[model samples]
Target: MGAFTQMIMGYVYPGKPLANATFEAYAMMCVDCGLTAISSFKLGLYMKIPPKAMFLSQVIGSFIASACEFATVWLLFSSVENICRPELLPRGSQWTCPYNQVIYNNMMTWGAVGPKRVFYPNGVYSNLFIFFLLGALLPIPVWFLARTLPEKKWIRLINVSTIFIAGASMPPVSAVNYLSWFAVAFFLKFVVYRKYKRWWAKYSYLLSVAIDTGVSLMAFLVTVTLQIHNVNGIDWWGLDVSDHCPLATCPTARGVHAEGCPAF
Candidate 1:
């Protein structure tokens, strides 16, 4: 029944199927919300909270979050320039908004056009289906061992979904983001946690949360201020760069392909 609804949505909007796309996203959101709630539920259990109160709190929290998040989406979409304009953003511009593009790409792939058209024989991405099938089948044996043995530590090493999601995320995300994330993650995972166990247990997760919050809040305030003052962007080395940088306009390069960008 839902499949038919999605098809009708695709037809009604021809090249644009955002409604069905949002519907499908809502479905996935519910699933992930449940997954997140399971961890919280376990914490509640450990804390000896009454089940009724815990459930009520979760419901209230989810409702409040949904409202605030939707409002945030409206504000950004209404206020930001070049949000959907990939071409307009010079490299390193904060407005590149890879996260929004990821959703737009997914909607076009899975909502407007169905998976068979996108993943079947001779499709542009037909080769990726093998990984999909592999991901589906890979966890069974690992799950079986974990369930049957219940105490084996080695059975938890297989997490194909996380790997796939991260692999997909990297291409759309800016290189600077990945570089910074890897630097911090490598330090924590390999150096800090491994070599300084006591310090890590005391400060690692809290430090990560603080950094993420601070960076996000700063970016928001900076963007709002720039917009208010009618500023395009700073022309410093950090903000102004070619889309492909380091090679798009190097002194050694030749021809008008660089669009007359002064060789740096």
Candidate 2:
């Protein structure tokens, strides 16, 4: 477990890694994942699956789902980068089309460069990865709790509240680029719940709530901690670099300039 934690921390914090801090973050994420898996198993059991099958299915499903999530982050990052920086893209790439420049720019502004820098100046990749992971893993605990007590309206309300909070905590920008993942999750959840209504019914509402709350809390905490540690006392989440950029054509300017030429 220690070695595994180190490996994940390496990917998350990246530059000049602080072993203790990295370990804590990694451990927190792992604990969160374990809780989610246990919750999922309980929900599965409630859906009438045999105990053994429920355990096996939860293990298999969680592993596969986690792997897919990691893959999704990689793919989404690449796709967004390609779209936003076409001049940097390969000549033969399909994403390099002229018509797609607008699409690319929009995604770049919303997902990769814009929000990334604003929310995580030190390292955007790891921060975004953690955000996505939190969102992906949180449903487990909620599902379990929901199944345990399916009659409560507050559980459903909490789940809905969490979703909104998670969305709110996310970088706070236009919805064009970021909405894709939400849409995907929504559609996928709809299909899963619709196709296996009985199974989903035992935990869907709770699972939704759990995921939302967990993700929002995690993102908020990390962002706040990093800001306090590295960025003086300012609220980094509220800082907007775009608002400070110069509008003129003196392309050689640098840093956070409010007047004079725009920096290249």
Candidate 3:
């Protein structure tokens, strides 16, 4: 919802990168904060935690989190040379900043460059407008199938919304990420639940929390201890690059020459 709103802002007020960035940042922040608050509130309700205490904790946590996030970002941008510039970053560097690169590309495409130039009737990507219609209508068949064939429990898994939502992260998240996530999820949710229902119910959430915390802590430690001091860790083929197909990013439009791509 926040992303859609910010996209509308991009369309309405084009060619304003700063405004776009500000709008997107705040809009996403508000959305994330609200969703997180709601989830925490629900968890608190389940645990029978007092509302007042939860509210107070949320307030304190928000301040500490925002400060830490700001400091981390400041440290990253300050310490890492060519932090968001993929073209300038050395090959095999861990600080490629994939997410930042996606954000910047989006800012240029939908904000600074404006969707009008990219998605106009005669534009290269005008066919993308069909997605609006497809998104709206795709659920109808699924709805009908579920209603007509109530016996098939698996039909409910054919979720168009989830597909689109997952697709939104694809530019920064590759096939390996998705495959690994799906594999882990299937193992935990399906295999674990079926084999050890009691253990799954009691420890699944804790495991998830631990994994999140561990990854975050390790990332922060690596940034401060190794990356800040330019100590390269784990020089290997796997760490060298994520996207093997460099030509996949090239413009498909005729006569559009991008560096390294063959001229059409």
Candidate 4:
């Protein structure tokens, strides 16, 4: 998934660092403002609302959303790591096996243990999170840009461009996945604008929360299942592993040589 996301960001954004930066910015925006604000802003302009109100609402809402999102991610990192670590380990592999231990060691060595990796070594994941946090704060400028260009054509163009850029940089799979949300946003913009009076009234905040919660739960379940499968020596998503013996094969299987299959 991460690799897919990287591919999509690369294609959509184009410039090496800049493309990634843009994607991080956009994701942070979504995390902070809930898709509602973004959809509402686009809808409002499409419906010819006063630019001032639209800008104010988007800015204020985005700020609040970003704060909440930051807090939520922090809490999840703290709590989920504690609950998920044991489950990430191999069934019988000890802490000393380099290949089997790397996951747990990385988890702890990355600051899930004591000194936070965000402050120390400042590794890739930490840097990525920091970039995301910083990007969340960029909605202010986005709001300003939206206000400066209230004409529906420009607004739509900009939105589409960014989405395309982000999508292109992402892996084909990730781009396809993220495009689902873009499709939803596009539909909402059209429907909400057409029926302005029923927009917020028909879609309760609870509905949004429910959707987000369901997605998160699904992700968690999938992660746990994959971890368990990997640890149990099952094919991890059917990747090629002919070089290594299946766990079912003991160290002294039929004609297998001792050196070639040490862990047989």
Q: Which candidate comes out best when scored by TM-score?
A: 3
TM-score of each: 0.64, 0.31, 0.89, 0.29
Over 4 Å off in model 2, which ranges?
1-21, 62-164, 167-169, 172-264
Model 3: lowest-lDDT 10 consecutive positions: 1-10
For candidate 4, the TM-score is 0.29
* lDDT by residue for model 4 (47-156), tens: 89998999897788769978999996676556443323444544432212233243333233322332232232433344444544555565556667788777744553
Query: What is the lDDT ranking, best to worst?
Result: 3, 1, 2, 4
Q: Which numbered prediction scores highest in lDDT against the true structure?
A: 3
Stretch of 10 with least lDDT, candidate 2:
237-246
Ranking by TM-score: 3, 1, 2, 4
Q: Candidate 2 local accuracy as lDDT?
A: 0.54
What are the per-residue Cα lDDT tens digits for candidate 1 across 1-264? 233344445545545567767675666677778889998898889789999999999999989999999998798778776665757765455666666676676668656675556555434666765765687787788788888987787668767677656655554665787788889899997899889999999898779879989999987787778743346565666664334455533444333245455643
Whole-model lDDT values for every prediction: 0.68, 0.54, 0.83, 0.51
Which scores better on lDDT, 3 or 4?
3
- Residue 205 in candidate 3 has what lDDT? 95
Each model's number of backbone clashes?
A: 0, 1, 0, 17
